[model samples]
Target: MTKILIIGATGMTGKSLVAEALSNGFSVVANGRNKEKLNALKSEFSGIEVFNKDAFDLVKTDFEGIDVIIDAFATSPDQAYLQIDLAAHLIALLRNTTIRIGFILGAGSLYTDESKTQLTNDLIASDESTKPWRATPENQVYELEFLRHVKNVNWFGVSPGSNYIPGKKADNILVGNDVLLVNEQNVSVTTADTMAFKVIEEIKNNNHNQTRFTVANG
Candidate 1:
């Protein structure tokens, strides 16, 4: 079985991904800053390993024998630069390591068209509406740059659908390169479950290496 490490495993999407990984028979090492929540998850999923640590502090020692690392942490939007710095730090630590890295990116940075940039704010108005997600900084751009400069590491940034929320898996997902993929109705969304499913699919297939891709339900 492949051993995988998940950063920010207590978050909304992260929690779902952890459950999915366990269900798919992957040995999972899940991380979170909150000990209580992390412990709760551990209790909920008796088979999975759990760690409480900050993202910037993660080391190969914490991931010994791990085959892959998934980053699901989100920095505060007011400190967007922190996300970039964290990516750089993570790349530095994983530079010579054998573990592959996968980032759970925010939809804010996805472009709706080749010439037009359609960020997350474009879809949702008012900070009150996007309060929860908007508080988290997005680094789709910097994450890609880090991958380009970092050698000996295979990395991928997976952006959720434009309107990600908790729901049943639609299984109607569209996958694409740098450009954001949306449905014919010009709206896109994916359930936390489907996003987890897609991530595992990419990990298993080793697809979209050193690149970023957007996913959405069709």
Candidate 2:
């Protein structure tokens, strides 16, 4: 079995990924910074290991026997740059190794059209309500750009649709590369369950290595 460790496992996306991985019979470890939340997870989840620690403080020794590490860490909008910093830190740690790193990136990094322009530009231009929270998406774009230049670490990233909600999986899934994904109705939304399914499915398939992809409801 592949030994997997999930950072930021207390969040909606990370928790869903942990549950999906366990349901599929993988050896899973969930790491977080909150002890109370970790204990809550232990009672709800029957067979997964939990670790309480900050993601930035994790060392190579912590990942010694792990086959894959999922970087699901999140931060406040003002401190979104930590997302890119954490990506670089993990990339530096896993260089030249077979251990794969999977990142959950924002859809703002996905292209909005064939011109290859990032969706983040449109987001910044169009929405005033998102202005306060745009830093997170902007930093996520930087994270993907940084990952694209890395050649030594086995890495891949996934972007959720425009509106990523916390909910059950949809009946259908639509996946794509780089570009924003939309369903038949032209709506771009993905649930936590669908995102987790796609993530664990990618971990199992091992395709899209060193690249990023997007997913949506379709």
Per-prediction TM-score to the true structure, in the order listed: 0.86, 0.96
Q: On residues 1-218, what C-alpha lDDT tens digit does candidate 1 reach at each position?
A: 99988888988778888988888899999888889999999998899898888888877677778998898776566776767777787778887667788888767667657776665545543456665555453445555566667667778888876678887667577887656677888877877887888898888998787877778888
Regions of candidate 1 where Cα sits further than 4 Å from its true position? 115-138
Candidate that scores best on lDDT: 2
Poorest lDDT segment (10 consecutive residues) of candidate 2:
116-125
Clashing residue pairs in candidate 2 (N, C-alpha, C atoms within 3 angstroms): none
Q: Which residue pairs in model 1 clash with each other?
A: none
lDDT against true structure, model 1 = 0.77
The alpha-carbon lDDT assigned to residue 40 of candidate 1 equals 93
Q: Compute the lDDT for candidate 2.
A: 0.90
Please give the CA lDDT of all the candidate structures.
Answer: 0.77, 0.90
